[model samples]
Target: MSALAMNETLTIARLGQRGDGVAETVQGQVFVPFALPGESVRAVRDGDRAQVVEILTPSASRIAAICPLFTRCGGCAAQHMGEGLYAEWKRQQVVTALSRAGLETEVLPVVDAHGVGRRRVTFHARREDDGMRVGFMVAGTHDLIEVQACPVLAPGLERAPIVAQHLANRLRASNKPLDIQLTASEAGLDVDIRGHGPAGDALRRQLTEAAERLDLARLAMHGEIIVERRAPFQLMGKAAVTPAPGGFLQATSEGEAMLSRLVLDAIPKAKRVADLFAGCGPFSVRLAEKAQVSAFESDKAAIQALSRAANHTQGLKPVAAEARDLFRRPLLEHELNVFDAVVLDPPRAGAEAQVKRLAASKVPLVAYVSCDVGSFARDAALLVAGGYALERVTPVDQFRYSAHIELVGVFRKTAGRK
Candidate 1:
């Protein structure tokens, strides 16, 4: 083999943003998958990336991965790191992102929100000559890695793999690629199958039978319900919500609770609050427990779900939900000033346009919940420039072992400051 493709010993110096270990090579920095900082490894180098051939010296922080499918399945990245290293790595992701944006604020240690593991997962299914394979894709590849079980899944989803395979088998005749999404809800497993295109009435009947046999709570194809044995309900605070099929949700139940707690605690004195980019009222329903909340979201289905949940729940402060694309038409300064505080849990893009409005508004408190730290940092800088003191940021690790980090930040308006 040429030097470029031969096995070479390298010392991992640090973990990169994607949880890959970085080593300073003679050529440049080489990234090795499944390697850890302070570990020396023999790997086959191909340009800037390498596959570890052997671990010559292991890092002290390295631990046995809980999942047997750890390195094979692309579901997790930091399974090898010990608890201390894992927590620090996740927390530093927030701190570094904020620092790059020139916003200096206290970032607390990561909160462990991996309670009962992930409640939702998507398994890709493809048919082979022998049979159909269902599991996660290999890291950086389209190839599927068959999984019998996943340690990172909640107990309610222990049968997700089996259920996915069963569904795939039912649709095997389509000969098209399939993506099956299963979510653990109070009613049972809510399943949504995609990638096989529109389903005919015949296929829907077949799927309905399959769902019945498997005892599924509900089944949908491409977000269209095939069978509804029961409503897939999720509890947000005291409200029972039936989120739109395949809608966005926090990875874990615990993650949502932690993020909600942080948001609620930040604006305790506020009477009226605005929830921008609110999805199915996770925070809105909870915030309504103590304050009147106005929620704005782009998805009409989500808005309807939130409204229905709010209306059905008792003893909650008035919750008014409106379907408005905040990106195109953010609430203006005058409209925003009506609320004492704003709690926004935007998508990964963050709420740049809406934050700009909040920055100029008289809203005294802003609780920002974010999934992407880079975008969050950029918006945080904008808020600080507008005279909002970023009190603190807390990183919550719901996607454990993965590089993704969620955070909640509290920003208070400074009196007489621009």
Candidate 2:
């Protein structure tokens, strides 16, 4: 490549979906990280990807990053942008998705749900001769960046890196890279270590001692309990739920509550509700307060947890949980008719098969919660074509500083739809 081609000064025109600033060049388009729109920057280009060397003219929306390791840690993007631009970028993600789907509806402003940062964090730990390196991976690379502290973590989990390091040091004898998942719960820090093989009696004893010293509520290796100081429970609405080891939880408690509220508001009068793809009853437990809930999920452990929570909790309407894969056998139209409304929170792939059945069903109201905008748009288009009115969508800023945005889209079946 020519020197001029490799080293070029470019003006950022817009931000891409992954939060990279896009610059139109004669060679097509270049994507530069840590650069904002309307800013002129000098970058070293390799094909269409560029590394920002210097910001010649910074945009008005540019701001100093709060975290020193913002660009290097790969945990957050767009942190350099001001709050106004950041919020608009997140909201426009949903707007762009809806526009692509050929559907236009009022989208509420993005809700700031990233309160006090993420409650749960996963650290990548690799054993070394000196000790263990524990933290997140560098952007687009497998290089581990040892984080001393993270601003994005919940206050309760401020010492998570230290906790993870302690566990890693104790388990370093196994000589295995580990993924340590830490969740700050009511009891204490719930620790789940993955990528480690079955622990022998000696290793188990060491882990137990480490857990005790670190004051962990629970410690599990490969989803099997090594030590349990207390039940690491999370309160979902009125009920207390002990989620499965290393199971999915919303990044922040505030995000979970906001999503639940939006989902609840979408189906205000729903007496009988089906919580599809329900994981550990975050929504089901809340919905059960006002409606009879049938929660279906593929994870047996999660369903069991939900079932146990519902059975023990008092004053909640009947909540029945079943372990069934909705992708393979979605609730058919006839089976779906029994519910007054339905709330489905599918994974990133976005529940195509299940949505097809929902479109054919007589369920009057459907609230779709999605993490991926592209998949949501595709599924929303399907529902819109199937005699459903695309109601207002509210985008939730759960994963802040990143391109990912969660949305709750309400769809109501048109009149006279059988």
| lDDT of residue 85 for candidate 1 | 88
CA shift of 364, model 1, Å: 0.5
> What is the Å distance of residue 239 in model 1 from its true position?
0.5
TM-score of each: 0.97, 0.98
**Candidate 1 Cα misplacement greater than 4 A, ranges:** 1-3
After superposition of all CA atoms, the RMSD between model 1 and the true structure is 1.3
Q: Candidate 2, which segments miss by more than 4 Å at Cα?
A: 1-5
Position 160, candidate 2: lDDT: 95
lDDT against true structure, model 2: 0.92
Overall lDDT per candidate, in order of appearance: 0.92, 0.92
What does candidate 1's lDDT look like per residue over 1-418, in tens digits?
2566867899999889999999997899999988999999999988889999999999989999898888887878988999998898889888889989998988998999999989999999999996888889997889999888888889999999999999999899999999999999999999999999989889888999999999999999898889999999999999999998898889999999999999988999999999999989999999999999999999998999999999999999999999999999999999998989999988889889988988998889999999999999999999998889999999999998899999999999998973
